[model samples]
Target: MSRYGPRPFFPGLAAALLAASVTAAPAVVTDPTAVTVALAAPVAAGMAPNCATPPALARSVSAVPWPQQRYAPERLHPLATGAGVTVAVVDSGVDRRHPQLAGRVLGGTDLLDPGGDGTRDCVGHGTGVASIIAAVPHDGSGLRGLAPAARILPVRVSEQQVVDGQGTGRTVAPDDFARAIRWAVDNNADVVNLSVVLYADHTAVRDAVGYALARDVVVVAAVGNLHGNGDPRPYPAAYEGVLGVGAIGADGVRADFSQVGSYVDLVAPGSDVLMAAPGQGHHRAEGTSYATPFVAATAALLREYHPELSAEEVAGRLKSTADPAPGNGYGAGVLNPYRAITETTGGAVARSAPVIALADDRPDPALVAQQNRRADARQRAVLLATVGGVVVVGIVLVALVVPRGARRRWRPADPN
Candidate 1:
């Protein structure tokens, strides 16, 4: 297995990665060339051993033998899917044609028109991040995304680390990022995933992040992959409104290259994370870029169950409910979608919302008729399916509908 480390956001910070695990005590990667892996320990009340299977051959927990990847599935898979929440993936666009993602991508814009696509990925980083949240995977390949039912809005940007044919490393300006944030919020995206980082004290970036916060849109960012040097906070991740995510290797310790400190919010599986590449098939990549999506996807899942919690509150819950306590670089704790989505505390907060807030407003007969027509269609479908001894869980499988003209790169995730 070839492991290419993500480029550093700062100078002199080399990326040294191995799968870290918490199933046991912390283990460090001595050989950078070796493909290190830390298999998820059998779900129990103990630690994960450092001697588990490697990522090169590790199947998703869903494919592993009974109880291997199984946890409380009932509690983990919520009846309420991420139907209403939309996630804007401001990265290298997405494969709209992927089965798992087909029909799920909402409208998106291309920032790097010269070398980008709303559906193409050059380095495969954006696709990997998108899959972590929405990829249903080609069956039996053993890749299960954290939020398998969430919808994504693929926002394209250049590879900050990669150069073009002319050999130019593009700079992701603060204004570009701010525009993406507002676009996500304006377009009904409940969450925004920023998988890249910049180390600048730009006021424009702050205002953009603050804009999302004011709108109650949850924003999650990659903490950054570059340790050893003093941890200078990475952009958006270091920004106050965003939840900065870190990476945990197989030993369950923070990766040598993962940045840390107060800016960190949570951690996730960052080493050799498997997902759809920019085009097709599966590939593995390393860095906090991948970890941030897990947090973003988990937030969507949490919203499906806790709809009223503001994005900030959701971030708080994620940090509060994370597993294995955070460390020098891993923030509040490791990311655990299974726990955060189903974990419930305190009496449920209920807001009193009236069906109609205006008494003098007159109803539009045409609009009412359209709504009635859709309602009738749904009712008939339910009745026919039930009476004929058949039923469909179509609406339950997703919270959002896959409309036409989604990302042009759509691909069905279901191999079947």
Candidate 2:
């Protein structure tokens, strides 16, 4: 299939493809080409996946801590652990009964299936994302989130289906997604986390995000992971005034599959992240979907610590304090949550930057070129290494299959 081809209607295919290509290197293309190609794809919504599996219970062990290198929650816990802040996770439903999220999740609505409450999650995606934001550690079995003391408001915008005992996955209509964001804003959510990607930019969604911004609500979204195909500017993330987040691995570099663009406000740990799954267990997931909550949780802490800062100011602080890196894709840089919370603002006022209505948030030309060059070089190196390893393995296999005498005869000719 082409990079921007129509997504498979069968949710299983989408999920399987996502899992298989979690680490695939993205193809570098000019902004215009990427945007045009991505626009050709059908407008549908689905969860971005690094990798996922069925929720199953695992044995409890001693306090198994999250990788501090990825997210050092302990460092900031002393100052502010998102106290008095409410983060709205807009995605599939969350498992309220999950051990990690039991007391933290507040009442929310299910826009997808109005008959059911938003407390139960059919697929574990929402729960996993929520856990990354506010899962409370209990008895050392559960993992602690970036803002453990923060409250979670689970707003279910998508519905998951189970066919033949396997999760078929979920989808959210643009209207529903828009409604969910508006609802979160109306409910006084301090931060809104959108983990899903919509192929098209719907007016409703954009307006909803604007409304949230007007109310000083910090909106964080995952820049879509399309296996490096096409432009990664998926909605809500593509919308102006929203903090678009990308994924970086433990190496502190952008993930090969992470979408790169100017809209990427910041990046956080996304690969092999251990989070709470649906059935009271934990799972390691990857994708920009997982990266978003770290930023959202950080926003909660920022809002809690500096209630005086506006949403724009909080976003500016994050950008201003981010670690500088090579590309426009990395945005300001990787997130420094501690610096964002503790550093003095120096009395700088937040400025209203121009909000581009276009889908591709146009990045600086020089920076884009540089980022593309670096990405291309890295991908080439990885490709060469893979090829070399394969060739060596093939040679070994051939040698093993050949007789001893044949192997000796096949030795390289001696050149004097």
Residue 384, candidate 2: alpha-carbon lDDT: 100
Which regions of candidate 1 are displaced past 4 Å?
Answer: 1-75, 114-117, 160-171, 346-416
lDDT tens readout by residue for model 1, 53-99 = 21122223334211114322335655544666688888756766555
Candidate 2 wrong stretches, greater than 4 Å: 1-54, 58-67, 161-170, 326-328, 346-416
The TM-score, computed over Cα atoms with residue i paired to residue i, of candidate 1 is 0.65
> How well is each residue in 1-416 modelled by candidate 2, as lDDT tens digits?
10111111112222211111122333343442122111111111222232243334444334544444445777888988998899998866777777778788999988766765567665566777888888886775637888988999988765443333222444555666678887887776888988766555667777788777766678898886664566545666777788888877777778676787767878877776777766566666567878888889888998788766667788888877777765657887888888888887523334457443324355534334535755776799899999999999999987776777585776657896
What local lDDT does model 2 show for residue 171? 51
**Candidate 1: lDDT of 368?**
48
lDDT of 2: 0.66
Q: Local distance difference test, per candidate?
A: 0.58, 0.66
